[model samples]
Target: MLLLQANNVERRFGADILFHNVNMQIDEHSRTALVGRNGAGKTTLLKMIAGITEPDEGTISKAHDLSIGYLAQDQGLDSQNNIWDELDSVFAPLHEMEKSIHQLEEKLSSIDSTTDEYQYIIQQYDHLQTTFKEQGGFEYASKMRGVLTGFGFGEDMYDLPINSLSGGQKTKLALAKILLQEPQLLILDEPTNHLDMNVLNWLEDYLRGYNGSVLVVSHDRYFLDHVVSQVYDLDNQTLTHYTGNYSAFTKEKADWLRAEMKHYDQQQKKIAKLEDFVNKNLVRASTTKRAQARRKQLEKMDRMERPTTDDSSIHFSFHSDKDSGNEVLDVENLKVGYNENVLAGPLSFKERKGQRIGIIGPNGIGKSTLLKTILKKQPAISGSIKLGANLEIGYYDQEQQQLHPDKTVLDEVWDDHPEVPETEIRSLLGSFLFVGDDVFKTVKELSGGQKARLELTKLSFQPINFLILDEPTNHLDIDSREVLETAINEFTGTVLFVSHDRYFLNQVATDILNMSSTGITHYQGNYDDFVNETSTLSQNEDKTTIPSTTQTSSKKSAGQQSYQASKQNQRARRKIQREVDKFEQEMDSLQAKHDQIEQQMSAPEVATDIAKLSDLQKQLDECQQQLDQAEENWTDAAERLEEFDQE
Candidate 1:
């Protein structure tokens, strides 16, 4: 059933129209991920749906008695109480009802055993019990506990002051409280940003099992891929819907853009032809009908505009030497941890020149620590880390460290490369979106992202062979990230980056060093390979053990204990098999989608018009090509898994 509806929704700010004619129906079972560029009014649209803000022109209706749980990007949860108290507060009304019911039961049981008053009270007591059960009172406590635990809050933390919790922890607690509320419509914004992967997975599972409607705004593709069944992309002052998860949405959008481009091409041709005929025949009285008809056709056409495609990682870079024989960094039995908790594995790892490695793990894992250890800001406890020769290292801390707050932006950027003129500095900064007066602003006055961009100017300066970036995308908006991504892609130097930005990882990494509880596992491909490997492994598990097919055999390399090694190996193989099976399933699905798109494009309604037909045909071609590539990758994954099964 539709939980909420928005018809002819038009929202405006000053003279700008954020969107218009956005008719929508949000159903109880549908999960939608809202996506748009920053400042595209996603949050504003959400506010309108929540009734917190009004649309300038529209009618919005909610299903009768429908309750919505709306969580803003940074939830302002007012509290000074304990965590458990804050969590249990969600059940306050139910708790009060339970108390009243219990009191009435006591009164009914205690007096006038055969009286009508007693009997009526007893009957009412039974009614209340039924009502409480219907309201999920029985599961309330356990569900609250489960939610807290799932979101990484320990039972011990239940007693801690909510005020003492970190901002991120507070966000998690707020999320837990909302989850426990279990409203008919759940709305969340960037809910997974501060969550670790394990918690994210738990949340994903929870949302998948949710009975209510779900709508969220998030940049985490993994979360969207797992939780959302549909995508509502807000673009160009319009709302467009696509069926399926993020990956499917990507393909669907690509096909749509291709179709649009084709339409544009065809319409241009038709317009040209009509214009030619009109120009040639309009003066002749004998051909007035043809000319008039052609003019009408031109006037009546609902002109098609070219659709934009994904910015597909920019093409940009530096020249580099491939050979390294000398040891650039050395360590023995290195170990790093904070407050007595271990961060990096005792088992040592090293980096050499000509290597482009990506360190990926859940948020707050040792990815940052490992990077810092290499930088020597954090000491390694017990394992050897030896960096190989001629490595001139340049580091990009996600924290935006290199920038000086007191310095002017121009002074900061030109301080090191002063030999270059001011014009060159301004021009270089302009590429990163710092234009005109922006270059003259003090670093202190700049926004976090602006400061990070200023710091990134160093990427243009250093003649270093090795670049170590810790979440270079942290301070970067999508555009800046794209610029830096392009520059990194073109750089001929060795790079080792620690990142959770999957898109960035997908485009940049040539190799992956995945840090997990079991230690580091090196994979020979980019981030996609890493995700496929891990996700594939996860699917293959047999209830308890996580098999590490490649991770096990490399004991001398991975340093897993001997007694459990073989068991791990067996499990790993099974997991690999499962992953391979999943790939086959996915590849088949992709092929089906390709065929479906082809059919739609081939339909007469879509294809009869030369312009529209050309567009559809072009999309059909891109889909076909994508399908072939997906199939090949699936086959390759299957072969590797087969090796595990053979064992």
Candidate 2:
């Protein structure tokens, strides 16, 4: 069943058309993604669907009483209530029902058992109970708890004032509230922005088990691949649908473009040939009839216009004037922070001239502080850092600290290199997509993404053997991220950068450094490699511990204690494993049933039968509920197992 449809949608900004004749549909239970380069109207299209903005020309059709929850980028909650209260407000209806049930119960106790009032109260109570169960009244609190924990909000922080939370925390809180609302359709714009890897993974699992249709606007390819079943590409003022995930979409789109371009070239050649023949033959009297026939054919034929592709992207490269020594950097027992406080480290590491190291950690663990200390932007709390000879460092600050907001884009670069001519500066800006009049605009007027591009443009011209980038991919679109990855991979200099973009880290990093409040742990390979290695170590630890109960004596030998601890650990693992297996089985059963219902819904007779359709929908809803419960169970079991392993 289709939940929402936009037919012949057209959106315009003043004289400029953002998109025209755009059509899309969201089916019941579908997971769809909207993707495009920055400023391609993807967000605009989403807004139109969400009823936050109206299309200039088109009609949006939705199921009757279709509930929708839309989460836009930077959408924060405004509340005087604490975190738990804010989230609990989503169940106001259920709370009302609970109150009515209680009131009836009180009235029933005062009336005689045989009285009509008592019987009436009993019926009301029964009805309320049925409604409450159907509405998930009993499970609402538990579900809210799960969402809170998944987003890294623990019980200790549940009482914190909503207004007191950080921007990222507020965003997470907003998302958690939306999840609890359980609308029929969920529209999320850049939902992955503030999430760490752990939260991101949890969200993927959560959304997969969601009962509603989801249409999301995002640049996170990894998240899209994991959650969305279909992709919608918005490019050149049009939208095209792909059947699979991001990776599959890429391959399919490439093949389609190749075929489309080839057919267009062939058509153009044929037209040219016909025109030439007609021109050569028209002058001769004997061939005049043939020429006229050719002309008539040309006039009658429908012309095919050449297809255009989007190519508005930054194009630039990084370079070094001189090579650094083999050992580019050495840090021993380094601690970085402000004042006397240490945010992270008591750490040590070495970076070679050609190594690309990626630093990653939870929010506010001092990844950026570490970078500032290395570049001498801030004082190190303790220890030492040594830079190799002939080394020049270029830094890309996530905050764009070096940019002069009052300076024009042209002057921002030119001021740094006065010897470079104005024309050359304009050309460089053009490569970064700041063309013509754009260069005359002040840096303060630029968007976050535009500012990032300007920063990269400046970084590109600098002569440096070592690069230190702090969350460089933060404001970039997917295409820009890929371009940056390519540039980093091709550059001969060493790179040490902090990013939450796992895909970027997987592509460019030769090594990974995991940072925390305690210290830093170095890994030999990329993000995936680090995860695998850590998992293996955790598994080994879990397997090696013995149960304490196995020790017979009150005072046991050291070897006996170790064996007993191992046995206890093994028993705990078995318990978690059993729970995991059970939930997995339940999930499989629900999926199979869901698929069967879909097949049944598509049948000719079932499609026409309203009663049958309604029945199937009810079945689907039940299946979704079971699937959701199964997923929650599995997540709890897995997290517990991980905690045990860590211990």
How does each model score on lDDT?
0.76, 0.87
Stretches > 4 Å off in candidate 2: 539-647
Tens-digit lDDT track of model 2 for 461-514: 899789999999988998888888878877989999998887788778889999
Query: Residue-wise lDDT of candidate 1 within 295-317, one digit each (tens)?
Result: 99999999876776324222224
Clashes (candidate 2): 13
By TM-score, how accurate is candidate 1? 0.75
Q: What TM-score would every model get versus the actual structure?
A: 0.75, 0.82
